[model samples]
Target: MKKIKTKEAVGHVLCHDITQIIKGVKKGVAFKKGHIVTEEDIPVLLSIGKENLYIWEKREGMLHENEAAKILYNICKNDYMCPSEIKEGKIELIAEKDGVLKVDIERLCKVNSLGEMMIATRHNNFPVKKGDKLAGTRIIPLVIEQEKMDKAVEVAGDKPLIKIMPFKHKKVGIVTTGSEVFYGRIKDTFGPVIREKLAEYDTEVLGQKILNDNPNEITQAIKDFINEGAELIICTGGMSVDPDDTTPSAIKNTGAKIVSYGAPVLPGAMFLLSYYKNTIPILGLPGCVMYAKRTIFDLVLPRVMADDKITLEDLASLGHGGLCLSCDVCSFPNCGFGK
Candidate 1:
């Protein structure tokens, strides 16, 4: 760093903040550190009593922190995401649409491991609304070696490290099982809950079937919904491993490949997921989904709505951070229920 006349400092980066005092009115930074001096800023510097300023000398192989932040943004940007204006050597990514946020954990970790820079992001596979903050990027020092940022770009490869999978509008069907609701023994509460949840997405409920515990009837109901062009089918109740719990078998009877019949998540261990013709999804939700504030259903719904495939490994991975504390005042998605 070297001191130079404020008039000659134009285009040079400030090495320290220029404080301005307005007697009893104000006292604050008139020019922040790292601010590139401009012709228009000379008067303000003079008014702040700074006849000369210390500035960082431009180096051949180093990039300013703002430049490094843009490099990190490039590594993470994808469709359906927009970058915030670079400010104070930092940048943030915001979602341009409601969608599921997907993070490349392996690549993100690799980039962060490079050190001197960082990209902090929200948990993967979670839902984000338009304008929601997705990730932030910045460098540790006021300036960094351009070579380190180059290495980060190389590690990120051609594909970005983060993306927003936009939700697709789906035609859905609901199969409500269990004789208690089927025979009018109890008012159907599951159907309403499922409908309300689906309402959050761009989904059209094709129809819902109320059926007894009979496996054959349940299987035919699922087939009927598929034949009617339902893209997704949800089977509520009858997911437990009991003699009468036949939702799993009914889904299998449709010749749909079962992804998994169980998950490690609590309040949703009996959850079942299958795909018909390797396209349409059929889920067997546990009883808890009808009552629990947040279950495996809430965690998986965003991915399903986004038309992203769920695999056995995906279900197995939910074991960590899967248990819902069931706080008296639920703050799901924002909380660590499924993070």
Candidate 2:
């Protein structure tokens, strides 16, 4: 990523109708920075006899065709009423490619009413600086006007709230380690269960491997996966305290830090969480991970694919609401607690 420049960089916009980009004219053209390109500017660029126009790097940051259009206007982000005056204060605004300005609530309204309204403004020729004055502040009259405004501004300051994005594109790997499972005493039911759960999210299984109960071999399998570009690793089976249960030891041998061992949740109480140095997650799921209707794996899959670093604290905190009631309805899609 390129970093935005300070005030010194000149911003330039496209000068011609290069959308079709006729041949013979070079693709990149250098122009003055901050030069607003209006709809009428297109004919002028063609008048100059230039077909293709693009921003080349300049001492001042060059403005491309898309970025230039977003500036040059005032926008309404939320529908709000201002009853008091505010000036010289900065309000965050989102600009679209068509020169529409989105007024951030910090500059337009108060926190209490932000959720209820999203109003648009049509102020053209609005001069804005990087962190410059957004708009004159105003207040909305209410029984508790001051409190309401405070809430509105606070809400405006934080436009979109952070959330645990569940179904993002992801690649998952599975490591099934257990002598009994590998030797076929138990059918490989864990693989199917894990696959079914992962399908709920936007994830693709890169691959899976089955190995005998050997911590060293399991550790090596996980390492091979990392070398092959596994983002999330799930190790199934052999999580009990038996001497044969070596998945945890093997994961530790790989130099990964265990986030939590044994959450308070049922069926999956022997689950393990660990992070490789690269922060790629390694999960040690119990035998129950294979067939439980709602194991701890079900509870944390979203957070895992969301790429969050699961901590012991996060697991400990789940004690209050982590218990899956296994409702017959299986209302998995809408429920937020498991996440």
Candidate 3:
């Protein structure tokens, strides 16, 4: 019985008899480090509750649209989806081309049928570049199956998609227009809603003023708030195409440049946006946003706070998912179209 001591182990070929393993794994199979002994070396390596051992080579960066579609279509690769369940947003089929396939969303969603329905939600016709997360079909209800996801990627023959970024936050100001709120015709709810939503981000409330919709008063309010150190000034009400809708006039009177007078978004089509001397942002909110759960304000607030340059092209992009369906079940987190 010969024993290999620690001192003698340094310069020795302890196991020369071991063979170099060349096992065939599923094309895009992966395994984390410190995983348990493998039953077979064909697919991904399994982690034994210690998942930090191996570095999983995940697909990274933005991907092209056709490339993403191909990955999505591949969900039905080899495994035939039930033909009957092909409609009703369930059971999808994709054809392979150029060594790639699209992810199968409907079929994957139906087969699992327990967790939140996974969707390959992507940016709509917005000219996505290479290595972008075009569509993410969340099949395991809310949970994404890592293995299945990797296989899906392999079938798609593209890199992993990096998550899209959300708008950052900047200081904002609120100017509640209309004599109704000033005169107590209705307990002002708009101000608080705007405040709460903005508070959810990294922004500060620069200033606030409750003024009657008098053009001069509103105009002065805009100047005072801007002078008082407000970067973004939002004037609620007085946004309609009526005589009393003095918000537009007041903002213009402040010598502010109107970026957009009306957006195509529903419940907020009458919304207004302006830049005051290029130093501040002045917004005129329509009546619908006063009590509406989600409005144009919500859609544009993040962009304003992030100091993003909003263009006509950007506003035009909101049409695809701008209307709030007001579904019985609050599908906010599940759907980001309006947001």
Instruction: Point to the candidate with the largest lDDT.
Output: 1
lDDT tens per residue, model 1, 1-339:
888998899999998778899999999888888898899999988888889899988899999888999999999999999999988889999999999999999999999999999999999999999999999999998889989999999998999999999999999999999999988989999999999999999999999999999999999999999899899999998988899988899899989999998899987999999999999999999999999888999989999999899999999999999888999998887887777
Q: Each model's C-alpha lDDT? A: 0.93, 0.57, 0.56
Taking the tens digit of each residue's C-alpha lDDT, what string does model 3 give over 219-286? Answer: 99888878777778888888898887788988899998888889978779999888887757788988
| Of candidates 3 and 1, the better by TM-score | 1
Rank order by TM-score, top first? 1, 2, 3
Q: What is the TM-score (0 to 1) of candidate 3? A: 0.54
- In model 3, the runs with Cα more than 4 Å from the true position are 1-169
Candidate 2: lDDT over CA atoms? 0.57
- Candidate 3: lDDT over CA atoms? 0.56
- What's the distance in Å from true for residue 91, model 1? 1.2
TM-score each candidate: 0.98, 0.55, 0.54
lDDT of 2 by residue, 8-75 (tens): 22343322224333369755543333244455555655555545445334323432322221221122
